[model samples]
Target: MSIITFEHSFFTYPQQIKSLISEGLVDFGAWYLMNDEQTSRRFEGLQTRYPDRRLYPFAKRDDNDDIACFDGSDNTTVHVIHDFANSGWEQKEIFPNIDAWLEYAEECNLQNESS
Candidate 1:
């Protein structure tokens, strides 16, 4: 399982998107760049280079990182940090950073690996 890290949260709005693109923080056909048609078009010209890989955006409704057993097929799942609600820890606060979220993911992966 390969994980890509973005400097900003997935819910980041417009200007941040442009800034990320300008800064080369995202790659063409990457989920952060090709998740939407508007952004996807920017890489349409390079489709031949990345033929097999289609971008899959993190689905907002199914944002939780819970695992579901699927009938043996190649599938991609994205775990967005915003989906988990802060349960009154530090007065019900939320920490929104990819680094923190990635740490959570690493912990989950570690537990899964141990089990």
Candidate 2:
């Protein structure tokens, strides 16, 4: 089993996510794992000061601001951090799971490449 080492706990990743990391599709250093290097990028650097405000950051958004996180408490549903109209900041579900999230990310990558 592949494990990501951290001070508090070791993080286990899904097979598909592991594959993406191996394939260089996902930045494991900046996503998937919570290391010192990634702390600043998560939640657009908000997590450093407001750790209570984050769900569980997994990836960064297409705009390079905000973060893609998952609700580790209730359900492991994927969420992207965003500033809503009146809600201020929130975890917006974009995909159901890591698999679906990866597919969406691939689509975005392709779009960026083509553009």
Q: Each candidate's TM vs. the true structure?
A: 0.27, 0.54
The digit string of per-residue lDDT tens for model 2 on 9-84 reads 3233345544555565644332343443563344345544445654555566545455666544533467766633
Which portions of model 1 miss their true places by more than 4 Å? 1-93
Best by lDDT: 2
Largest TM-score belongs to which candidate?
2
The C-alpha lDDT values of all candidates are 0.32, 0.52
How high is the lDDT of residue 32 in model 1? 32
lDDT of 2: 0.52
List the pairs of residues colliding in candidate 2. none
Model 1 compared with the native: what TM-score? 0.27
